[model samples]
Target: MAPCVTEWVTSCTNLILSATALHSSYRLFKDHRAPSVGLFLLGLSAALCIVHPSGSYLTSIQKEAEWAGEVLAPALVSFDFLWLSEDHNTAHILLCGSCLLLGLCDWLSADALTVMTRCLGLSSLSCCLTVCLFAGNALGALSGVALSLPLLVAPKVGAITFAPLISPAAAEGLVKWLLKGSMAVGCWASTRALSMFLLDVTDRCNMGI
Candidate 1:
């Protein structure tokens, strides 16, 4: 069936464009600046898939199957299986570690870093810190899904699963805080309004207007 261009307008592509605009807005706000809980979770999801349980990084898929029976399914509620194995838990550690690394690195700068610069966060030594890390991250995430398709659909020869992140663990702590700073800042922003609403409704009934 030939589809509707109008409906497609509200799809993932649209949402991403909107997010880019918001991200840009946040950057402006910082100067402006950026991500929070929601963005952190989203970033984590992309990272895990790239570093798939099979691990194209530390090792190839075949070498890690026994251990990766561990990573396939995302921990919907917690990080239990993620860091569960203690010693050999490469997949979980790398996935979560990436977020923490990014958060801690970005805090040093006053301005928001781009995806190319994301890797710089991993290393203070990166000369093209902005391009190597931040821009790399942005590219990785935008491309992460398409990269995971083969693993996601292929028959499971191993115990692991390449999946999207769904739990709080994915966000780490600092990353979530960065992404959701606006939410926190907004909370502070709404406090005066909240106070007036509360006082108007309960304790101060004597006002005439």
Candidate 2:
């Protein structure tokens, strides 16, 4: 059967957002050799597959591959920060390690992994936002917010169980598509937001201002 209007819209949105994010990540990678950013790019690349029109029919192996990227992207970002931080206090190191462990343990359970990754990603974004706010960089903060806000709704979109106007099966299908789209938005926004913040910091350091 042909895709309905909703599927078309959702797939288009996901494709656009994921592609934009992938571009931002590529530009950042060109300038910096940070493993975290590279991992995020990998994740975004995997995300492109999930947002495709036939995403709903992904094979089990394909789904697992996508989930692996999702789980590692945020953890790697935190790990990168820890590696770069001047003051690697015990608390900070321990926290990052703990989160990485959680992602590893949650790996087999897709739903649990999604929630964990989002929380980890949000924490990383929040740290970036705090730094941007302290530096009075309105644009960086805006990007961070753009990245974080959609994530707050993503879990809820997946959890949606009913729509009075539609049958339960249709509602479930709609929710799944919406969830994929939301995840694509999260991938795009997170990479762009994080990369912008890092770029701004790099500029300030280089200028010594």
Q: Estimate each model's TM-score.
A: 0.19, 0.57
lDDT (Cα, 0-100) at 190 in candidate 2: 46
Can you write out model 2's per-residue Cα lDDT over 10-66, one digit (the tens) per residue? 556556655655665665565434433634554464555545444455555455555
Candidate 1 on 108-189: residue-level lDDT in tens?
Answer: 4523332313332222112112222432333222222221222233222233432354223322322322322322232222
- In lDDT terms, how accurate is model 2? 0.52
TM-score of 2: 0.57
TM-score of 1: 0.19
Best by lDDT: 2
Candidate 2: stretches off by over 4 Å: 1-7, 35-58, 68-103, 106-115, 148-162, 165-209
lDDT of each: 0.28, 0.52
